[model samples]
Target: MTELARAAAADPAAATSPEPVPTTPDGVPRGQPVLDRLVALLDLERIEENIFRGVSPAESPVRVFGGQVAGQALVAAGRTVPEDRHVHSLHAYFIRPGDPRVPIVYEVDRIRDGRSFTTRRVVAIQHGKAIFSLSASFQLREHGLDHADAMPEVPDPESLPSFADRVSEYGARLGDMAKLPRPIDLRYVTEPAFLSRESGPRDARHQVWMRADGSLPDNDLLHVCVLAYASDMTLLDAVLVRHGVYWGLDRVIGASLDHAMWFHRPFRADEWVLYDCASPSASGGRGLATGRFFDRDGTLIATVVQEGLLRIAS
Candidate 1:
């Protein structure tokens, strides 16, 4: 077993749970429980051909994690596409916060089906109001011109400890931040947690190695959903750290505003994918960051862009 695999095996949360059944008989484990719970709580039921209604849990807050809805919506859309065609890109906007106490309906519109591509449009609604919308594209694998920019060299995933270790060491100092859901194993390459105090202007780029905590099936759609879940982990934080604002700092209040991603090539989430990210600007209480994902062989597999609300506490 790999060191990461060992670390995951040692984790109580990961080790104790019964193996999760995939959404479909042949599907893979998508491993985002909060998302799974949201899907279950919403009691997603098919209302029309290729259309799904997602009801939210009464226990959740109205404004949902944009990533959760986006990932789930992608799954809903992927279910309609052919197995060979994998999602290549997705763009979405959070028009409003979804009320968790109520159900959010997801409607998938099949826009086009071509020899090599399929497009889908999704609208998420709450209380008879549109709350979020997304457009996603899928592509059939084919031989094509292939080249990728060089992967940024960073510390290997083996050199860093699991995030859980860091949190256990810090204990109560991390408070609620420590309890954030972490379905993927993450290890920082650029900024080790120990250097936060000795820093000057921080490096704009950040890289992490990640994969699902459990074995996943061979379906491509499950990998896409897992990518969507892991994508939200730390890209925007690169923007904040560029200015030296760690999460616990008194003045920082950051939340993701919008997220977009494009898959460039085929890759497995079970393997280490280096998330190379950088921040371009931060002004007017918002910051933007972009990232590229590269497999172990340096194949560029995806690109991600996100903007977040960064505010100073009064």
Candidate 2:
């Protein structure tokens, strides 16, 4: 097994079955909770040749995160490609809010299998209607001219405290922001939490260090899903910072409208990756942000772009 797989195996928390369930007093599975359990609810079953169906438990709101769906769809598609090939890019659209109470069916269509690259399209359906779609490309790694931009200098993840630690330190002062489900550990290299008073004029740039709470599978597909999950965390917020609006502040409302990513190289998600983000424009109550992910060795693994609905309270 690869190091990632070994690490994942070592983590006691990573072995939970992908079935949504409520946690007991010790965070072990008990029954099921409406929102919290959704993260665990993807049932994979074969439907057709080169196609699979994923079902989720019935709940009012969809229990799956958009990134999770994208990542899972990528995994389904990756299964059809050669193990040597790695994901290079993915573009997906969310057509409707997924219904948690209903199960989603993902149909993967093999578009082409070329010598150097393979392509696939995934359509996520619910209630017999298409609610999400993704197109992904995979490529085999080959030796060639290689170069990458310098990694951004940032404090190590160890030097900074986890977001949860900060929240506990702040207590009720965190307000509704504390309610956000923080599955990954995040430490801002530029702006510390709850230090808005020290924040000055908005800048387009942001840098942070991140890694999964535990190790993940060695499979490139799983790493890509982890990247997809982390990609959505702060790209939109970078735009808000450009406008001098802290998301935690009561004066602003923000939501991701669309997200896209391009994987440039293979990298382990279990390791620390430098995320450098910037916002180029914000107008008409909308904002656009772009980001790049670099491994510790300065390999540019991925590039991301996102547009979000940003409305400042009047």
By TM-score, the best candidate is: 1
lDDT of 2 by residue, 78-105 (tens): 7678888888888887777676665668
Worst 10 residues of 2 by lDDT: 30-39
The number of the candidate with the highest lDDT is: 1
TM-scores of the candidates in the order shown: 0.80, 0.79
Tell me the tens digit of each residue's lDDT in model 1 across 169-193. Answer: 5535656555555457677777743
- After superposition on all C-alphas, the RMSD of every candidate to the true structure, in Å, is 7.6, 5.4
The global C-alpha lDDT for each of the candidates, from Candidate 1 onward, is 0.70, 0.68
lDDT for residue 179 in candidate 1, whole number 0-100: 56
